[model samples]
Target: MHLEAFLYGGVSAVLAELASYPIDTCKIRLQVQGQVTDDALTAIKYRGTLHTLMSVCSEEGFFSLYNGFRFAALRQATYGTLRFGIFFSIKRMWNDRGGTDKNLPFLIALGTTAGVTASILTTPIDRMKVLSQSTAQTRKRKIVNTFKKTHSKGGISGLYQGIWPNAKRAAAVNGAEIPCYVFVKDFLTNTLGLEDNMLTQFYCAVTASAVGICISQPFDTAKTRIMQQKTHRTDIRVYEGFFDMCRLTISNEGRRALWKGAFPAWCRNGPWNIVFYLVMERFRKFDQWANQRDHSYF
Candidate 1:
């Protein structure tokens, strides 16, 4: 079950990433737009999701929107694999140990644990993805060059920038996303007397995505700023830590800055979640069918 969960999660995540990556690029750009304190550049470059999308397409070319595609896809695969796999594995363990009634809190705890573990393990790839998509210069830079530069600045630790905020963001996202999906699906099926079909899954995924984005946006904003900040010395970063990042952003860019790129994040994650749940649900049904057929054969 764990292996199957990992496989389904990775496959769905890669496909979802491929489908929604341009929006993600736009989100990153918007999140890091006014990070610099230059008075001349204080104006927001990317006005919103549509404007950012149009600007990137026109100025940087359409393909540039997929900058750092490989890094982001890899991060999605590994992180998605572990998060989903661990969540299901732990749930199975809980069920075996007389946890027959899985409540919202129980599922949320599992999802958060899985998300934190995956986020910590894959923070470097996430850092690279953010750095690669944060600006026009980074959009053209290769991941190897980015890796070398980051390594030069802070050795191995450089690549793991923003791990704290990233992990927190993951916890928020995962805690809300998967649990909401499961809870909503169950409600639709058992309470509302709806069929467990694609329509139900679609509704559940959209709800989950919205909840995840709302909960995670502030942390996501901080993580992007911290990861994309220009640094000469690793010890002397613009934002010392997660709280420092939030404090500086609120002070310099206004409190609203904590939710920067939130719309774009929802646009990206909404489609991503829909695709992920659809694919994962299909795979699960197929696996169940296959197991049943094998048992009949035996």
Candidate 2:
């Protein structure tokens, strides 16, 4: 189960989620903008990330920024824990079979595997999050109501809507994020002969955040749109699936639309990467120290 990996990943993810969630809310709001299907949502023009943050606070109150936070936190705990746990578990197995940590391909594969697995398993929470965040923030909505609405609208499939896009986004994100962080950290520490410290970790996290955001933003945009689609409205279908969403978005809004909310995503991801990797590394060091102490006692 790689319990330690799961524990560390959950803790790091929840803490990171807390720190970056407002930016995340802003990102979601931006991504859903300029979409044809968003007519059901309140029409609030957000100029940019800052504008969105300001507009949301002015109109919806400050706490509106943290709307759907419970779902976000739960999503992180389940998806984050599973992804990290599975990644490290597979990594350990591969190492036992004489695989090298220096292999970039293996790291990417592990990340993709972990991300897809986790995203699939915890998709309901993700759906609820999108539903809550993409709605008109003018009205205070309960997270439980979001769940009930989804189930009533489409049953289990409703909760699983956008799973494919979510999975792709997760795969892209984790594939880039964890591997970039690990690779950069390894290069700096092992090749450059730099000590493992906060500075080095910071550099690695920044690189990873940039790479991850670039690779995953499009899928993230698509996922948000798909999940935000009103299932109750059978008269209008905005998108059939992930590729359709991308095509329509590009055709209607231009290629740049795919990268919508990218700045806010990066803003959220930068701190998220730093916090996650820092905490993860510290947990790993503690685990190693505990193992060493136990071995010495033995």
Candidate 3:
């Protein structure tokens, strides 16, 4: 419910996102590659972060790097708004529900509530982002060229191809992230007696974001893999559910298989989330820009 926290949150996530785009692409690619006789990471040599970007550009095209960028940017901005907007508002409502921040278990509640809300509200947008990003650019099927192909797969339903697992990923991330962040932020402020100002909020938020990403990274691996697959992969049935994804990873590759593109995920999510939250907090407190300003479709 703190204004400073809200503002900082948005900034934190956005900065992190731009920085992590390459890693994000790598993780998405690795996950979608599906069953692995060899670990996707090891096979690729785990060479620095940009291997996926370089590989995609070499194999696909330059535009492939930006395949879903329009959708992703919009999604980030939109969810960023709603998440901070709603999270703070809701935290306000329930603030009265507890005694002190620690006594109230506000962190867990914040995580679950904000996560669920962001998951449900942004579900469609995120689905589109995944759909667009997952589909690589081919000679004939560049981004704009394949717009029809993307929707034509299953009409409207195709966009939400793996909605269930997406929800699980969302729920797990938000459920753990939101609450953990709040609690840690609280702990830092209340226990450590740090000033409940912007600096403190920023530090706490960064820590919370890191923790949340770590908790739900596995689900993220599974979720991205499921979405990034070609619609007609015969051998991809193994990645049907979230839990199924884990088992499939182990069976096909090894326990480390579940960690496909783990490095990029950490790279992409960890810092990006911090920026996202930071920027979001700024938007909420100081500046009053209307959400979704003149930008929707690419």
Candidate 4:
């Protein structure tokens, strides 16, 4: 709960976000391609990770891979600030009511509240990020064309067409996923008597995120699906938007169709989380220094 911890969380979120862009790009393609009957990975064949990058470049264009990266950066900055600073502040305020570190329920509440608040605040930005990344074409590659097309649709709000779906997605992810992360960290540090060193901290951090990720990935898949549908929610099309996408998916492909991109998700989650935890360590240290200096904690 030190200032260093907050700084580390913020730094980690940004660094991890940049590091995870490739996996994210691939994930977007998998979902936007919309072939629920098949494994999303098999949709594209490339040599390796670098090959995937090359393919997206040669096929999708150079700027294709970095689609919505700016939006993602914004979301991470906002989410990280709220999650670490606001959530911790709220948690601490609640903790002042008197409770032992052994209270898993208390910690869960803190993580959930923080995740929910951050997700809601940043959902609009995240929607833009998703739309930008998934604006792929089975036909040709035109970066400017895609941008113009998307921008012309509903402007900024058009890009954020699926914020409601995202809210649902965030609830499961942040409500349960993030809380479980801190819970795991707490268990490892206290009940398990784990040392509070770099390795332990990193493990705890990544483990928390990874677990949260796995739990929330399906919802993420659903969210991406909803956003990339390219029609008004009120449209009478068989699949106008998120809820319609959900209905079509369930009726056509069954319930499991909703989780079409889990494989790529795991691939994305591993590296993304590794980078995230490592970066968070630095942020926490920075937060600590800034807070102590400001408060004269010395």
lDDT of 1: 0.84
lDDT of 2 at 39: 65
lDDT of 1 by residue, 135-190 (tens): 67533666678789888887787888888988999999999999889888878887
Give the clash count for each candidate.
0, 0, 35, 11
- TM-score for all predictions? 0.92, 0.93, 0.75, 0.76
For 86-132, candidate 4 gives per-residue lDDT tens digits of 55565555556665445667666676677777777776667667767
Q: On a 0 to 100 scale, what is the lDDT of residue 238 in model 4?
A: 29
Put down candidate 3 lDDT per residue, 1-298, tens digits, no spaces: 4543344545555565666665676677766554562233224432445777787778777767666666666566666555655565566555655444463455466666666666666655676566566546443334444445757775655566667776677767777666666677678877888875667667766676677676777777777766655555354343556787788678767786666676677677666766655554555544434543332100
Query: What's the CA error at residue 126 for candidate 1, in Å?
Result: 0.4
RMSD, every candidate, angstroms: 3.2, 2.7, 6.3, 5.1
Question: Which prediction has the highest lDDT against the true structure?
Answer: 2
Where does model 2 exceed 4 Å of error? Answer: 41-44, 138-145, 293-298
* Model 2 poorest ten-residue lDDT run: 289-298
lDDT, residue 24, candidate 1: 95
The list of candidate 1 runs beyond 4 A from truth reads 36-41, 96-102, 137-145, 233-237, 293-298
